[model samples]
Target: MRYPILIEEGSDTTAFGVVVPDLPGCFSAGDSLDEALDGAREAAAAWIDAALDAGMPVPSPTKLEDARRLSGYEGWTVGVVDLDQALFDDSIERVNITLPKRILRRLDDLAAARHQSRGAFIADLTMVTK
Candidate 1:
């Protein structure tokens, strides 16, 4: 999804801030505009990951015009972040990943406790975190 981001310019006393209007609580900051935007992408992904983990419906991306209509956004720079298809992709593609036996055991136990398969449990964590 292409989510619109608002970049609030900062002066010498503060850092640039980014806010993803479509995703509440999704924000980031950096010394420069580029950095702030890079952080915003990561923030957006984390937000979606958290929502998915919580079993909540992922909110649709707000239109750019609608997002800009929100008050208090005057003079803010706008940009769009194109998220990876994997965030919404349902096709299964398997690969090998090596992990410590201890950690693997712990993961298995946790997945079982949740009444979920190890792959699903791991996929949720890895997708959000990676």
Candidate 2:
């Protein structure tokens, strides 16, 4: 997804500031335009990750034109950050992890008792523990 960023231009004495309108309270800063943009992308990803991990719904990105038209963003320059769609995807992906045989056996047994695969069990446990 392409999210619009508003960059507050910086001079030699100040750093560039960035804000992601779609994500409330998501902001970043850097010494240059490129750095501000990079920081914004990282901030956006981290924001999304935290929101998803907490089981909160992410806000959809407003169109560039709409974002630019926001009342307070008149003088700031705009930039687009392309976030990977996979970050928002819930699709399963195969992974390999090695565990102690006894622990693996216990996990499998518990998973079977709960009618869920070990991966699903582990995922559920992780979310709950957090």
Candidate 3:
């Protein structure tokens, strides 16, 4: 899954640094943004390999709340990314279904009003309906 990468922007020792919260101890650094990103990719690869080897739970990316907690780290600011969508897509399933024309139209209207897709509307309805 795509875990959030937190780049601490201001550090005296490192110009750029990456921390993959999902992968404990998975961290890398560089003197520039490009280098930092490269380091993060390498770190992520090694992190995944080790996790697989140890049969450990791979964590999803850290959220804003988690990143905000790192504010205590001196001279560091967090940067989060949603770049790992593909990794997490497996967590959900996709299904197709047919509905009556009138029901479909009603679903479409409801979805538009809620700014959601018909599928999403159906999902929400399922959750709240008996």
Candidate 4:
């Protein structure tokens, strides 16, 4: 599912961050724009996993009428995201990965940079790993 991801470049040209508004629970960052996007995709997967695990209904993308209802709201902007159900249902294989402490730390950092919980991050990695 593709979400409307907001990307902002940091002070360093290569540094960036992304926020998925619909899934306010998810965020991501990277050393470059491309990395940020990749992180965002991972973050989205993680967020969805967590939500599903908790039995929380994932909110559908807001339509134009939904945005219109919020027109004139203060200090906020809205963007729509299109999440394909087919993409959400596609899960390939699962592999058990036991990494060293350093690599785990890096994974944690990446997940945190995206504002995702470790469980969600792991679930995402498990779902899409080739």
Candidate 5:
């Protein structure tokens, strides 16, 4: 998903500010444009995660042109923050895969040590690495 963002140019004394218009109350700041945009992506992800956790609906991204027309962003730069759709999906899915016997044994051992199912262990690891 690509969310539109409005950037307030930073001055020597201030950091660049970013607002994700599609996500209400979601914003971020950084000393440089690159940092600011990166922050925006992180902020959007966190916002979506929180909303989902709270059982609230996640808002879809508005078009760049539409976001540009929103009030109070005049003179600010416009950009888009791309997010991985899979990161926000919480649906459960079952799949089959083949693993080497040695690796499978290690995975089962780790899951047992943590008192978690093999699927839960893999899911937890995936989230942490991501």
Candidate 6:
């Protein structure tokens, strides 16, 4: 998925700013164009993840041409950030894994303490680490 982003050019004394129009309130900044775009990608991914986790629908990206025509952002440079399609996928699949008995026990204990299922606990941990 390629999401269109608007970048405000930066000067020596300022940082570049980027905004992901598809995802409201998702924005990022950096000292250079590359850094700004990278930050935008991360911001967009995090925005999608949070929306999915909260049971909210993630908006599809508006076409680059259409996004460019939107009001405001007049003079900002336009660019596309290619996001992994998997970021928008929320399907669940079952899998089997082998773990040391002690580790399994500890995992179960931690999950129980959090009042979450083992799978839920693992998923939460994976997201945090990512």
C-alpha RMSD for every candidate: 4.2, 2.9, 13.7, 11.9, 4.2, 2.6
Clashes of 1: 0
Name model 6 segments beyond 4 Å from true.
106-117, 124-130
Q: 15-88 in candidate 6: lDDT tens per residue?
A: 99999998999999999989999999999999998898889999988998987887899988888999999998
Give the least accurate 10-residue stretch of model 3, judged by summed lDDT: 81-90
How do the candidates rank by lDDT, highest first? Answer: 6, 5, 2, 1, 3, 4
**How high is each candidate's TM-score?**
0.72, 0.78, 0.51, 0.50, 0.71, 0.82
Q: Give the Cα RMSD of candidate 3.
A: 13.7
Q: How does residue 67 of candidate 1 score in lDDT? A: 76
Error of 1 at 30 (Å): 0.7
User: Which lDDT tens digits does candidate 3 get at residues 67-125?
Assistant: 66765454555664434444323245788888899988988999999999877788679
14-35, model 2: which lDDT tens digit per residue? 9999999999999899999888
Worst 10 residues of 5 by lDDT: 121-130
Writing each residue's lDDT as its tens digit, candidate 1 over 14-90 gives 99999998898899999988888889998888788778767788888888888778898998977788898678655
Q: Spell out the clash pairs found in candidate 6.
A: none
lDDT score, candidate 4, position 75 = 33
- Runs in model 5 lying further than 4 Å from the true structure: 94-130
Model 1's alpha-carbon lDDT is: 0.86
Clashes of each: 0, 0, 2, 2, 0, 0
Which parts of model 2 are misplaced by more than 4 Å? Answer: 102-117, 124-130
Which of the two, 2 or 6, has more TM-score?
6
Top candidate by lDDT: 6
Each model's C-alpha lDDT? Answer: 0.86, 0.91, 0.69, 0.66, 0.91, 0.93
Residue 9, model 5: Cα distance from true site in angstroms: 0.8
